[model samples]
Target chain A: MKTRKADPKGVMTGAHYLDGDFALAEGALAAGCRFFAGYPITPSTETAERFSERIPFVGGMFIQMEDEIASIAALIGASWSGKKVMTVTSGPGFSLMMENIGLAAMQEVPLVIANVQRGGPSTGLPTLTGQQDMMQARWGSHGDYRIIALSPDSPQECFDLTIQAFNLAELYRVPVFIMTDECVGHMHEKVVIPPADEIDLVERKWYEGPKDAYRPYKPDTDLVPFMIKTGDGYRFHTTGLTHDERGYPVINAEVQDWCVRHLIDKIDKNAEKIIKLEEEQVDGAEVVVLSYGITSRVAIKAVQDARRQGIKVGTIRLLTVWPFPEKRVQELAGKVKAMVMPEINMGQVVKELERSVAGRTKVVSVPHCGGGVHDPDVILKAIKEAVK
Target chain B: MSPEAKNPIENFLRMDRIPHIWCSGCGIGTVVSSFADALEKSRLDLDKVAIVSGIGCTGRVAGYVKLDSFHTTHGRAIPFATGLKLGNPELKVVVFSGDGDIFGIGGNHFIHACRRNMDLVVICVNNFNYAMTGGQVAPTSPEKANLSTAPYGNFEYPFNVPYLAEACGATYVARWTVLHMRQVTTSILEALNHKGLSLIEVITPCVTLYARRNRLGDGLNLLKYYYENSEVRHGADTRTLDIRFQEKITCGKFIDVEKPTFLDCMNTHLTKTLGEKFRPYGV
Candidate 1:
């Protein structure tokens, strides 16, 4: 679908020094997100702070809700009111948000959530960085559904991918996640905000048919339904239950099948269009290093050292983590001798890589158990081992 | 039925979705009827009025209403309504849900919303138990009240909802029973006109579960009990309004005073701080 230019009112359009969290906020504003409901969680608080400070000038709204559950619930409510909405949280808050994340997905509310990764099963290292929530981002919410998740390796990419996250959210009517770690979230760097007209934003596909004919969940050809804002005279109803096209609860297996399939297929069938990977020199490499978020930056350094040592190593940095980019990984697995994956978590995303590779070649995991990033030498050794 | 011959409130209901999931003799339907009557009486643009509900039997009110409605997750109607109102200040958002949804699992949100005085009308149908879940113990269940979970009789204390609302800074507070249909309608209409967080707790009957478990007979018997036991005490101190097991219920418009709502405070503060540079949101 064709996209529109960002609303100039929200565009900062300048090069400024910012952390990833602040850049994520700017990116959201540029993407026409006018409503942000979030709670203060370390590593993610700066985004909410930035938003609360900036949104008033943009004619937008920012609310610090009572909790993460209310934060996400508010975002869904705001989204239906025809505003692009988002929230930022850390691990604990993300866990609180899962139930409503499932609500947003099931109701097909376009929402963006940024989980600034921190070390944890439960508030383990609040001030430290870890990519531990990678798998949780995919499967945290219960039931069978698919959501788009993007990882940014830098403050600049934080701005870029957050815009993409909102676009994907609007395009697919799904909850999208900006999965960045505390290292990048707190790391200050130069981020350039381009002119509003240059930045593309996907507006919601709003239904404009006769009010009486409006069916809240009737899918268009894209397997995504058009949405209507509340108080638009459509008088439509939408629920979290397994619902029919009319958005009414239908307690039947057939309706459940349709509802779940609609949620999953909207992303799965469009996976190729949604998956984005930043590849460097993978055309003819014996070993490939796959990584995302802050680990991707670390992996690049390791790949450079391996190349210096005469190993044929390439890098594939995942920009879009969910929808997995499995097909590309499978193809690369066929050509490469092995793939080495490094992540801040012990083994979250590496499992996906191993599954996608499917024993076509060796897949190695260089896991870090939170609080810090992977050392370059550790990833280099994994690359060397994969090739050997 | 022909359009003119049909119920006047039919226009405000999804008539096709009738034969609602509500049980026979359930008071939730009466509350809905009163709500529709209130909507009609208010003369507000129906198009701009939105209804939000949390999970449970009363949560289904959103689906049955012919308005832009949201049946959200359990215990989230207030925050969802908060979002809806803040997202579009022009839209009048009302939260219609049960006592368990609003006060049990969602108590924190409820208190905070009242504290902020978020612009919303919360119609809480307090049936004294988690009716939708087979009369389980709820935060508002009366002491020693029989229920599915509290089969022997509930020993826990129940909340005085109006008292909680008043303590949390609600701009308007009222209570009525489903038997007092006209009073419920009037209170709802008054709530819709109030500028801040207005909470109207409607004591209703859950015949299938709450009433049946307590041997309170059918919904009609419960209504008869309400008619006989309810006391009209306008401006009564909210603290004296708790409904004990089979005891007299104090019902009235106990609190009504104006305070700047959440948005009002936001716009006022931001305008003062940011001056002409501030583009007032949703203005």
Candidate 2:
């Protein structure tokens, strides 16, 4: 991977106190996100507001679209135009965006969506925290496809992981989500943005081969097709249908199998490189607490509390949530007595942990129905029960 | 495959993917022919032109066109074209879709894009019903028109789309029936030449479902009706342009006025506010 410095025009190279939402906007600018189209929803609206206020100064464009569907659709068009694009939304808006997210997946369009999650099954809570959309983020779109999602537990991580989100989106050519909740999105913390040369970004790979041989859906060895910007004279065609290597729609079981499998396998096969998990005292521990986003930060306090009571409790904080870290979870399932997971939702990510554990170990879910974060004692009790 | 003589317009089509899903005697193919002719007459660089469509019979235009085309999700062609135009200012983006896709499922985007006056040429093929999904009642389905979803007869008032376009601030607005071949093609060419948001609503025949369900005759009979009952009213009042079954169809350019587009307004505002500090968007 060839790495270069961030453009000085976009990088705010200094340490400053900022909220997670603003930090995410800054992260996008630093990572070369020059276009953002979005609808303003609570907790996520700040990100859009920041982009609108700041993008023009940096030679970028920000469009407040009609709704989340159009926002994502606009992002796809911008992506094909050789721009790193993104959108920010909460639950209801996210729900509206689900159809186009499928389109982005089908077309393998690289973009970022900062889902600053608020409480919802349907407008459940607008200003409060919830991780209810984790499962929806993984499988919200109606189809078989794979996407990359990252969880940032703090304001600093929101800035850092958004950059990672853009890089992973480019590398995998899929929509990468920054899955933060109201707690993380609103929390203010000191974030140090490094110098321009210190930041590494993945540039969109341009197709340099023969124009006649260019096939929009044909994958390279790495399973990602190179992109050609619009007006590049290639004049290729793309659609949200089961297509052949030429990007022409081919509706049949044979082509469907070939096309859908590539969309899944591209990320599945690269899961090892794509998944990132942070472990603390997991080795030789009797109980491991697996968590992500704001719940992971809450789980740390519970882990420390459990240790004081002489329980051998460890922590595994998930940074990348979608490719699920199956290998590591499978390895840990055999070693640990049990695993306890706490999420702001009613057992979303914990279900993935259970799948990876596959009955090898007991998996306990600490479910919260949103509107607020979990109390440390709730997770502490779950950890204690898991070890027993 | 032997070298055989082909139509000259085949250059604009993905001939390999021909035998399109449009039904026999459908007017969508005629509209496509008119669009191709418009492109040929416009004399613009074909490489810099893009076609975007939402899901419908009309949406298939993107797949058939040999440009940088995108068959996006339903009702999203306007916003998608908005992005393409703003992202690469050099590209001329056009959105083509059916009335159901544009005004029914995608109505909000249509209004918002018009309100923004986004620089796009949007061609809506209004067949009065959702033809692709089996003839169901749509926003433009005339009152008392029978459809699958409204078998008892539609009670809701259908939209006068040309009025809606003008009300939402479209810089150029026109209406034409498929029978008006030369006028339809000329309107498309004029829309392509205009700089801001231009909309052309084409009344086409959905003979298979729409006509058969409503007891109307075949495609030719509908074309005959259009030829006999239509009135050419240049710059007519858009509010009176609604179509009723077997009624006089008022068709012409309803609104054609110059106004600053979304990009122009945005760039002008930024340059004035930020002065030299504002780096203008993609040229």
Q: State the lDDT of candidate 2 residue by residue for A233-276, as single tens digits.
A: 88789999899999999999999999999999999999999999
CA lDDT of each candidate?
0.92, 0.91
Runs of candidate 1 exceeding 4 Å displacement? B1-4
Top candidate (lDDT): 1
Question: Model 2 off-target regions past 4 Å?
Answer: B1-4
After superposition on all C-alphas, the RMSD of every candidate to the true structure, in Å, is: 1.2, 1.6
Instruction: Give interface RMSD, every candidate, in order.
Output: 0.7, 0.9
TM-score of each: 0.99, 0.98
